[model samples]
Target: MPPRQSPAQKLAAKLLLGGEWAPVTNKIGFVKRPVDQAAVEWRKWVQRSNFQTRDGIGVTEHQGTLTELLSKLLPLGYGTRWLLLETANPEWTAVVENTTGDAHFQYVLRHHLSEVRKIPTIEVQDEPKNMKRLPDEMARGRWGGRNLTVYDEAGFRRSLSLYHSEPWKFHHGGEPYDFEDVEQYSAPRALDCFPHETLVHICRNLGLDPFEEDFYVPNGRAFIVELLHDGKRSGGKKYTLAEARAGHDDISVPAVDDPVIGNALYPSGSGNPNPDAIFPSTGFESYARPTPWDRAVKEFEECLKRYSSYPVRASFSDGLEDLGIIALPSLSSGGTGSTDISVMASATLLESPLAIREYTAAFMILQWRQADDSSAFRSFYPNRKQMAVIRRIYKEQGLYPFDAGSNEVYFNLAVDKMIRSVTELRLTKELVDWEASQPAPSTAEAAARANRSCAWDIRMHIQEREDEIWNPELDDRA
Candidate 1:
């Protein structure tokens, strides 16, 4: 519970908010506070920031006691704070625009808890508000004239993912040209689109401290705020947190310690990779928790070769012990939880010829990791020709990802049966899920896993195998 705010303090809070606070007991406000606080770190941060002039939630009759006197919601722990709230498009746009992530949201969330619930609302700004200069940062953001119209973070990444299969050359009949040839456009590194990276960027730009564990946990005390509307925002277009993850994956998200639902959170690589681009050891990751597997077709697409996808030349299979990656064949593809990372063949992918085959092979391995019966997992995608067949069946036969385990013969056979046989599918899953899956968490783990995968019989089977390709035209929709 928050310490009681007095009548004067309530009035001051109203001044701080620049609008009316929610009626305290009615609890009309949303279940909030800690999430918004962790995401934006507003209520206490403004109180603590140093400036010759300041306002809202922090100013006091007596100064110098910033840490001891505040709420106790945002507790410090690994992978804890970001768990409080899920973000969508509207919230993303707002945080980019102002100190408070969303004023409209703040309005909806006012008077939301024990301490925050009591603050009075400011009906109108004093005509002399300008003289106060920095009466509050909220005033500057809300009234300060930086209303955001869109979240540009999702910009053009889809173009990158579709590069190979859906080439600009094929789409518009234009001559071969790179994505960079377009005016006023430059591609963002895979790191730039990452959800966690965006949050770190926002905090540093605000001149506020980043959520690097030590700095974020102590001042975080807004957990008492209830979750209102089931964590969805009111009156917005609502691009889901999942969509953001997809867009980021199409561009960038670093490797986590675990390929799926990582036990450790350090990034293996990032988009920008500058000293600044080097991700903080601790911060928020908007990546959604791993979706549960249907458990039916768990061993769907196992393959033998593992390698660094970049050059498409090196194989880790022969020498897993050298790399230090432990073998988990004790856990077969079926024994392990799936990696959600999927990469698409972006429109601009045509420009990078080398990545085409590499992307195709890696995409297949990822699908193998996640052997769900979802429509996206029903087939392998080695090329555009194969993807076309899957998409056609998706439209004609009515297969959807959410349907998971229950769909009639997708083209003519039940989806799981199709997976048991070799077939081609579309490149629809995001690279984030793809990126997240390729970890040993340690080189030793990678080596050991490879060792298990290629153990005696498996190695003999690989030598005995002939590479088979399915021609989509051969499928008479049967």
Candidate 2:
């Protein structure tokens, strides 16, 4: 007899609306909120299971609907990036993505049929500059960031002889392509069209629509596990790469095209460069090109705009009313803390382009706490240095320190100002870091300029989001 199926190894699995569990096969996953609800937890699961090397994952959902879902899944198998889309899709799973606003693309892949493709494909990017693999870079000729490559996946493989669409044209891989074919100007003749158009073209060419609802096996078991790791997600303090190195006491750099840097970071012959440096993609690939901090702030603002346009589907209760607190929704991405609290967990911004996930309850409790009266936080999470600042701010500002009688609105405004100063304070500290990296200044004038050289501005993260004080007439911006 076949060995009995060991009771589906007790994973923290569940189904929507309490669907029954059973010994299952043909497993697939639906990641509705991978970053917010699942990043750490799902990553932990993958670490334990080595899922990428074992069971394959696919984007069975059509690109017509699962647009953002496509971005979140890239990292699951060695590919993860917003910029890496054009290449990763065909090698991993096919995806179609089209979004309004900036940072957009229309692309698809059929990793399922990648193994079956007979013709080889090519992709040259703007920057193999952002990867740890130089060998891969040297192999895939740099297209000076501009490239014309064949679209070869399991579902659609073509050998188009080039007819000049722009500039000088060359024969398709040296052979003249037929411009006389009736369906010559086909949709997605290249990687420049929507998924629907591509699917239609594939339908005409391959005679199948994998996107049909019936194409997916019914009752594919679903799971809804409470995220196993909920501690704040944060990168370490911002420092130059030269200081974060493994040896030399510390230093680092994001390995890009520079061969010496790549060799230094990955050391030639190191087996399959570590995939943990940043987002995964073939242990290579640049997704989401690094934008300047100003652009990042714009991204954060756009994120806030789209999130309220489509609020998260997770279940949560603010507990603000219970604490008698109020707040404004102004927020920025990244973690925040009340320096006064040393032991209590602080709030953080979940990083994603599609949504903003944050712990606002901490901000609520923080918003209205009067000096010496916030025993809920102060008594349990006292930090001498941070609380001392709070005490000083309360006393020096000529503000009410102990009274909580109808002063919450005024107190919150005071706290907003305090956070503004704190944010400035945070940026101001960067000079110290800069000094550590620089040689001792020979002249006082140079020192003065260096003191003023903090490259970052206040993040404008001077207020809490998602928690609120509901006095309508007080702040019009709110």
**Alpha carbon lDDT of each predicted model:** 0.23, 0.24
What local lDDT does model 2 show for residue 202?
Answer: 35
Model 2 residue runs over 4 Å out of place are 1-156, 159-183, 186-199, 210-230, 234-478
Off by over 4 Å in 1: 1-447, 450-452, 455-478
lDDT digits (tens) for residues 149-193 of candidate 2: 233433223322222232212222222233223343343443232
Candidate 1, residues 1-478: lDDT per residue as tens digits? 9988543234334321222211110011112223344333332322222211111121111111112211111111111111122222112111111001112222212212212333221111111011112333222211111111111122111111111111111111112134223321223532222222332333334332322223322433222211111111111122212222221211133212122221112132111112211111222122211223212112111121332111111111222233342221211100011122222222222122332333344333433323333332334322445434444544443432313211211221222223334434322234223433443534332342343221222212222231222444533232
Question: CA lDDT of 450 in candidate 2?
Answer: 35
TM-score of each: 0.19, 0.19
Residue 19's lDDT within candidate 1 is: 21
Residue 306, model 1, lDDT: 37
Model 1 RMSD, rounded to 1 decimal: 24.6
